[model samples]
Target: MNRNTFVPVNEPLLKGNEEKYLLECIRTGWISSEGPFIKQFEEQLAARVGRKYGVAVSNGSVALDASVAALGIGAGDEVILPAFTIISCAAAIVRSGAVPVVVDCDPVTWNMDVAQVEARITPRTKAIMVVHIFGLPVDMKPMLALAHRYGLKVIEDAAEMHGQTYAGKPCGSFGDISTFSFYPNKHITTGEGGMIMTDDPALAEKCRSLRNLCFKPEQRFVHDELGWNFRMTNMQAALGVAQLEQLDKFVQIKRRMGARYTSLLAGIPGIQLPLPRTDFADNIYWVYGLVLADSVPFDAKEAMTRLAKLGIGTRPYFWPMHEQPVFRKMGLFAGESYPVAERIARRGFYVPSGLALTDGQMEQVAEAMRKVFQ
Candidate 1:
């Protein structure tokens, strides 16, 4: 165990104008949700994402909820999602009053298996929420074809995949609507914020109006419909503007780090490194994930314990949504088994792959891993 070095799973990289943006926000006195920074951030992000409109919100979950709500999805409708992602994806669907249909993930990409998604669609299926897990872009061609055939909308949960591309198109631009999280651990940080991107002007307007309490343009106090206050502060938008300016550079660093880890751990036994997909031109490796082989002497928990003792932090993949207690009580996914998601959850462990991590630090973590698996 290295007492001097404690490698965390992820850390935010705040450099190159973050402080300046904060200072600018403070000086301008537009720290609230309404200001020039928010507008600027939305426009810049829209352009960067190749979308016609971008709606800034309080957080990723809220952005997702807004997008779903904007689509008019509610009770009697179903949204298909993979069981191997953050709970927020399911939460957003539930909040929008839609039934969440949990599907299996592709073992290779750890993303929604397009084949499984097609199998789960029903007459009530209104949308599909595809998460770009671990910054790897999901194969959208088949998913898009399925959606088109079924007349289902697609909402991309691109929280972890900033600056990632599928073929030549950006990940966030593939679906009908895409949501991003600017949380500290994500590729970019705005302290706590989110953005929704869409090419549909009507959907974009609905998102913007829903975020601002569904206020009508003709009246100040009159509300057209029920809505939540999911607005982002100008301060956060300022940070986001600065963060966006350096997103490409940050993604490049992440790619290099991922490649280095892959090279260093290539021949190591009992470890399955994430494979890059040619369909996706770039992968902004948010966390360098490794799946423990079933033949390994230890389970993912045991490996995590050993790594923690070695001062190396690790995180397990998301537990299958069907197995969660909340969803269990809801009885939405009874007797359903997503074998791939369950296996990944039990065997996957991702170590520190933050932007702040140095090559030597990664080497040290890899050494510790080698010691554990040996």
Candidate 2:
């Protein structure tokens, strides 16, 4: 490895028709929220995920917020979800004046523990927000069963699992409402954008209204309800359309990259490689992560620091939300413990798994690990 060179954790691939579509928007002056590209991107992406309608939003966090709002999840409603996930999920629940009931993840898949989900349900529980983490679908069958049995809405956070499926169905297909993010690090990106999708037309319209500041279509500047400005721009949707066109190719590339990393790092001592395949399918390594085994004297933070010194970039897993200071200050999840999540958060993190990453870089990264262990 060159001492002067740094290998980043992720680099988004954008070698499609992004420029062509983007230029069209520029020429036509269709740069704002209402444009053909927005609807086209929304419809195309929604169909790909087997949903009837898609509403473009400003960002992923608001996608979640719009979903919560569309479902009428408010004041005194309780939403159950995994503790080991991005803060956007919990924040959406909190913002809607709903309580987020946190649960641990399965030790193997690192998705939510479906078994634990049932236990968290109560008379006030109104929804289950399932986040398909690290590009793997949560085992949705059980989650769906519980949702049906309890009459609770299911919101699929398919932001990470684009082009991924569960039991031969789309990741976004099972939930009543689903959301996706187009952040640069995702499988596909619009620089910064998001979408909310659903089979229910009413929910879809409600999400659209919430995304657009609740403007009454019949009159201008007349509103009955408060809403945020979460409308995605036409330029972003143009980029998204281009990205979506190449999403299948990107998924294949990601799997290839993940397999190469697994093969190279197989049986590395003191660190446990991410499972090559899970019960669902080949573990699509969003970032090629390694968990320091209990036998190791050091933790993931120390390992990351060592790798950084070697000019290799890495990112740690999400710290369990139940342990967050902000949530604690709010008196939420007080004294709650999710042991599996806590363990992985301390030991797990990913190396370079970017679509733009090369095989040669993986070799260097694996070699750097050998040096770190020594």
Candidate 3:
């Protein structure tokens, strides 16, 4: 590989039935949300995750919003989640007029510290939002136990854990409502889409209604409640249906990429590689991230700059929700601290680990990583 060849942060693998299904959507003129592929994609993905029904939405963020609304978690309610996850998790709760209570992540697994959750529970806490960060599933058993004990709802954010399992159970199966993203960087891509999955038929119907502006079934034009037009188009669902067929293969590819990177970049100084596997689940390498050791002189932004100069694309980790200026101005999480989340946000970054990444590109990334450390 040429030293100047750029290895992107992510790219989707669409060599499966993506083209065929997309063409069918075009030929049939079923490009809208009310197409056959929409239901097919929903059913297929739901079944894959061991859910009784799936509601397709425009994107992952809205899926969270829909799930929060469907669960009837709103004002005066509090939802406990991790400080280390995307803002969408917290935003969903806040948007519903509920308060978001955050817990720090485990240093090793980068998942919510389940031990901290029990202490945070209060009379007003109505739900727990468990977000599986990167590739590792959050320690679910204890979280579920807590939810059961407290009579609280569980919302599983399995956006990065497609085809991933936790102790022989599917990641999405545990939540009252679980959500997934179909971004291009994900294992499967609907170009841009998301889904909400659940075993409860009423919850599933509520999500479907919410996705389409909460219009009444009997009276289509009459609106009873507020909702957003978060419907997923048939074109997107066509891509999703095709992509679902290849999920197992995609998971394998992701695992292999993770393994190869771990082997290639082992023993490098000044950086910490992702833990290859956990007791409950293997790392899917959602993105092959690295954390700068304390000895490193620069932050993740600087590391990303260095990698970019070497033609190796990289991305910084999620900024902690507590540190966001917007949230601070809004008087949320004031004076609260999550050391693990803060440190990782400053020091963490990920290298190329896309499904479309070629072996040559992986080697190129490895070589670039070595040069960066040297």
lDDT of 3 by residue, 1-374 (tens): 46448788998898999899999989999999999999999999888889999999999999999999999999999999999989899889999999999999988788899999999999999999999999899989889999999999999999998999999888888969999999999988898899999999999999999999889999997999989999999999999998999999999999999989888888789988888888998888888888999998888898889889889988888989888887888899999999999999999989998999988899889898888887
Model 2 per-residue lDDT at 294: 89
* Colliding pairs, model 2: none
Give all candidates' CA lDDT scores: 0.88, 0.88, 0.91
TM-score of each: 0.97, 0.97, 0.98
Residue-wise C-alpha lDDT for candidate 2, range 1-374, written one tens digit per residue: 67437888888887899989999999999999988999999999989999999999988999999899889999999999999999999999998999999999977678899988888899999999999888577888888999999999999998888888887787778879999999988887998999998999999888888888898999869999888899999999999999999988998999998888878877678877666776666666666667788899989999999999988999999999899899999999988999999999999988988889987788889899889885
Off by over 4 Å in 2: 1-4
Q: What shift in Å separates residue 234 of candidate 1 from its native position after superposition?
A: 0.9
For 72-109, candidate 1 gives per-residue lDDT tens digits of: 99988999998999888898888777899988888888
Q: What lDDT does candidate 2 reach at residue 282? A: 64
Clashes of 1: 0
Kindly give the stretch of ten consecutive residues in candidate 3 with the minimal lDDT sum.
Answer: 1-10
